[model samples]
Target: MNHFKQTVALKDVKCFALHGYYPEEQLTGNHFIVDLETEFSPIGFDDELGQTVNYEDLNSIILEEMKITQKLLETVLKNIISKVIRLYPFVEKIDVSIKKLNPPMPGQIGHSFVKLTYTPTN
Candidate 1:
């Protein structure tokens, strides 16, 4: 069901990391981006950073997860989901998107990506 209405998001978080199916692609890494959307408990009068999730911390988690080599993008995304859940339990829903800017595919293929949306149970 539904819970929260407000959202905290981070978009176009770019980084270079080792994640690919082939050894060459993994070794020479490529530009990668991770976008996030999270819905947490509504903030009251506290107005403190801790009251809501931190964008930088989320980026760091995404970057750290991307560094691990994986043959499939889903694996990377799964890692992020688990980490985020552990970090921010109040978050009711989350959307994490991972994009490989320069995929090693054929010519003209701009990028490849996997985006996952999650809604935790209360």
Candidate 2:
């Protein structure tokens, strides 16, 4: 049997976070781009908020987690993914990506990013 695939996405969620390997980053902070895509359980064609993914909840989770101080984008990404999976069991698969804009580094660079994908085991 094959299950129907449905996706819910939150894209280009820009936020400011104090996460970096340097002291200046922790002090001044930087802009980050966040994107979330999740594969959720389907319950027919009902138009119920409870039966599907709530994007508000997803946004809140990312916003809340981004405030905490972290040394690495990977850690931040991991934490967000873990929290989302734990909070919403209906989420079967998820991909989260974080990009640090204008990273303070040598040479010219656009941004640094970290992405992680999670799939539940049943």
Candidate 3:
């Protein structure tokens, strides 16, 4: 029997962080939503924690990265992806998206976001 690929996802993870180009934006902080998906080789029918990526670990990484101040969402996304890759070297692919809520702008703009997909080269 052929086993399909496996994926673990952490979706709609909410966070409040101070990340922006402007100093005031960092000082004041803002709301953010994070979404992540990680794909790895299939782990057959074994029900073991070590067999699959842990969602809690992913959440912790997201929260930890969010606390750091960065001028660009792209930077934050990269940082998160790098950390995850470091922890799970077996990870084959990663998809991440970060949304900044209620951005400071003259006109009405709900949010701005950065989304990235990464595949490790071996």
Candidate 4:
């Protein structure tokens, strides 16, 4: 069967996070940017919203994942991907990118981030 893929890109989703290895970083939350690309095929594409993924719900899922405290961005990304896949069975693949606006690195304007891709298996 041929599958139809729909790509959704949510860019620069601002949030406050305590995602870092240092104790101070976790104690004091900082700004974060999350980008998501969710790929899924709607069961019935008759221009009906119900037949496809609800973007509002998806945004909530991302926010919920961001609420959970984690040291590594990779872990957070993986968690988001896993939750998204679990919540939406039609989501065959997802790409997540997380960025810290201002990191604690010396002479650097911002911190590092991570990006990960997830694909569900039948």
Ordered from best to worst TM-score, the candidate numbers read: 3, 2, 4, 1
Instruction: Point out the higher-scoring one by lDDT: 2 or 4.
Output: 2
Better of 2 and 3 by lDDT: 3
Global lDDT of each model? Answer: 0.83, 0.88, 0.93, 0.83
> Model 2 compared with the native: what TM-score?
0.92
Ranking by lDDT: 3, 2, 1, 4
Q: Give the better candidate number (2 or 3) by TM-score.
A: 3
User: After TM-score superposition, what is the CA distance of residue 118 in candidate 3 from its true location, in Å?
Assistant: 0.6
Write down the RMSD of all candidates, one decimal each.
2.7, 1.5, 1.1, 2.0
The TM-score leader among the candidates is 3
Stretches off by above 4 angstroms in model 4 are 1-3
Please write out the lDDT profile of model 2 over residues 12-109, one tens digit for every residue: 99999899999999999999999988897586677888777788988998998899999988888888888888777778899999999989989888
How close is every model to the real structure, measured as TM-score?
0.87, 0.92, 0.94, 0.87
Instruction: For residues 1-122, write the lDDT of model 1, one tens digit per residue.
Output: 65556788889988888788888987888888888889877765377887788888888888788778887788888888889889988788889888898698779877888999898655
lDDT for model 2, please: 0.88
How accurate locally is residue 33 in candidate 2, as Cα lDDT from 0 to 100?
94
Residue 79 lDDT (model 4): 86
- Give one digit per residue, the lDDT tens place, for model 3 in 48-79: 88888899999999999999999999999999
